[model samples]
Target: MSKQTQETGGAPKWSGSFGFIMAAAGSAVGMGNLWRFPMLVGESGGGAFVLVYLICIFLVGIPLIIAEISIGRAGGKDAFGSYKALNSKWGGVGILAVITSFIGLSYYAVLGGWVLRYIFVSVTGLPKSSEEFFVSFTSSTGSQIIYYLVFMIITVAIVVMGIQKGIEKSCKVMMPLLIVCLIVIVIRSCTLPGAGEGIRFFLKPDFSKLTPGVFLSALGQVFFSLSLGTGATITYGAYLGKDQNIPKSAASIAFFDTIVAMIAGFAILPAVFAFGFSPESGPSLMFQTLPAVFDEMTGGKIFGVVFFVLVLFAAISTSIAFLEVVVSFAVNTFKVSRAKASVISAALITCLGIPCALSFGIWSDIKIAGRTFFDLGDYLVSNVSLPIGGILACIFIGWVWKSKNAEKEVTNNGRISFKLVNVWSVLIKFILPIVILIIFITSNPWIMNLFK
Candidate 1:
């Protein structure tokens, strides 16, 4: 493989394996970890869900990460370009991934804005009523859009700086700080008087709670948390050098992402239980329930700031990856400069996000197939596009591109030794496709309602 990009006047490679791992881990670590994963653990029978989730991460998530990164390093191009380079017909799968990332980012930025607002709110003072504050903030169209734009600008500026200077550097700073903040919160949360109940609730497994649906939920969480089928791993992998070990690097990404998520649960659920709140609070757990928990804690304001800052870091880290996917596609496909692509893509995403921002306010009544714009967009990306892209990627690697070539990429063509290459091959070729398909089918409200 070449050291610099063949196209785009020699685009730079990742600074080193560590930089690649951080960037990829940043992409993998997002709201899915901070927001969704903890909620899933809360609602899905705690330790049982955690156990299934861990198993899925190894069997399914890690293998998919390996597959996506291998494809990118092998193709040495943008996500779409990489697939098109290898097989013309499989190009659409890359497009599916890219589009999924784009749509995901639209609503994702709105949530980032909410985190920013909450960060300020945390500093100012805790709200008497967390639910009312969240509702008021989200319903204020002007405020929501302004915050959304601010978040977009921040993300765009990072992408505009290019990979090493922007994404990698910011992640290096933010990820460490994020981890520290999590640790601090975990310490405080666990020390609370009634915290052990929540800890046990999160840690103790009841095998009887093991159901097929729990496994499916765990699989979906794995896909969402890892940024699988989103063109992120693939795009980041495009910038990786031949010397970097794909399997090892992918493992690091998965490990960091999973650890952050488990830590987030420790930081969150314990506090929730300590404060006499329900664990199964769903999406509002972070926005609504956590603030109330913070309200009750000693030095809660400081911890609140740290927690939201942690959340913001997670949000921005992932948002930049999402934007990079689109920007890289624009830069590579349209043959535009990085600045031009970044600006245009940022503008497009901002525009597209307008309705999503409005979904909580004036557009609240508007529904697409009984979902608000934000809900519908989230459903499509998470349930529809993500699984399709993942399934197609598995097929492309297993049958079309063939697992052997992908294995060669992961092993760096005999330079590196991967003992689990056969295991990864079998998982990618046979297991992941079936598993992700089940996630897709079970994830959909419409489809699942049919059986109900």
Candidate 2:
């Protein structure tokens, strides 16, 4: 319990703030940003959705992230341990966050495998019918499971290298490469013959398209894209150095994450528009629509390869963060070594993910509340666990731990200047909980049905 250990939150203090920032940004910048954000934007009214999403990020996402990091840095422990160390009764909230991470990753890895498979498919050249190819590949239970395990193994291997040598090191390389690839694609997408329409759709607000549903979608995207409500942020915070400015670092992470999401939109939407595809394609936008766009574009095979590779990096970066949360819990709680914890955690998560992969084909009819395993996992995590965890975390900080103390942590015991410290306190303590609760209720079919 030396000052150094407290500051670093134990040894291997992220190399420096830059490394921590990169790793944190990597965690926040995932499929949520790269895949979901663009689809939501396209479906939810493009520029209008983007505007509301930015507002949601500021009011809810950043404050909650700052609060979580403050909790982590203050407790200097894993998510559950951090809460227990701060106030033992609130430990359940931490556990909830960890569970969120676990469930999220279980299904997320399946999608990651899809991205990995697409990378090779892009290189090999997309099939004649992108939709049929997508349906066929996703329905192949054995192929899906194999790719899922392969993705998990790659994730576990990186995590087993330990934080600095593993997560941080990989992110440092991958994030930059991912950004570069995004830039390349964006340029190509924008310069296409009819790309202006897509850019206009993405950047020009259409007020008529704004609705309560669009607002909710934007809110959800902000929350998910930033990796809020998951233990991933708290775990990353646990590795932060005392000298690191929490608010500034959190802002930087949010900025990078949002920028990436917007950039991803530019990369995809322009191409979608140029090719005369529907922007309202939902989740299938990435897998089904984009392949056709690539197939038709000049030199698209090259760009397609680059696009999926970018997505693969994003998928890996986030997967490692998710795996790290579970692995860190095991190491801190059970006193297991990092390597052992990683192997066990990864194995369990891989097994858990199997059903999600199979839900596409073999287990397609197997239903929990009429949802296949993949849909069920997504529902429980996105609609249930994440929102509940987020609401409770806000309560823990704003009430139990006191927003003042959180502010202190963010401001480094008041040494660092936090200009909007008061605003942050109010948002975390009051505004956030209500907003997130609304999102929770509105998102859940069961809850919505209760009122109806």
Residue 339 local lDDT, model 2: 91
Question: For residues 12-110, what per-residue lDDT tens digits would candidate 1 score against the true structure?
Answer: 677777778888999989876876777778667778888888898888888999899989988888899899988988888888888988898999999
Model 2, span 1-452: residue lDDT tens: 11223323254567777778889899888876765777677666777778788888888778888888888888878899899999989888888877888888999999899998998888878765998899999999888988999999999999999878899889999999999999999999999999988888777767788988888878887887787878888888888877788888888888899989889889988899999998754458889889889999999889999999898998899999998889888998999999999999988887788999999898999999989989998888888988898898889999999988888789888788889999999998888899899989888778889888
For candidate 1, what is the lDDT? Answer: 0.88
TM-scores of the models, in the order given: 0.96, 0.96
Off by over 4 Å in 2: 1-9, 42-45
TM-score of 2: 0.96
lDDT of 2: 0.85
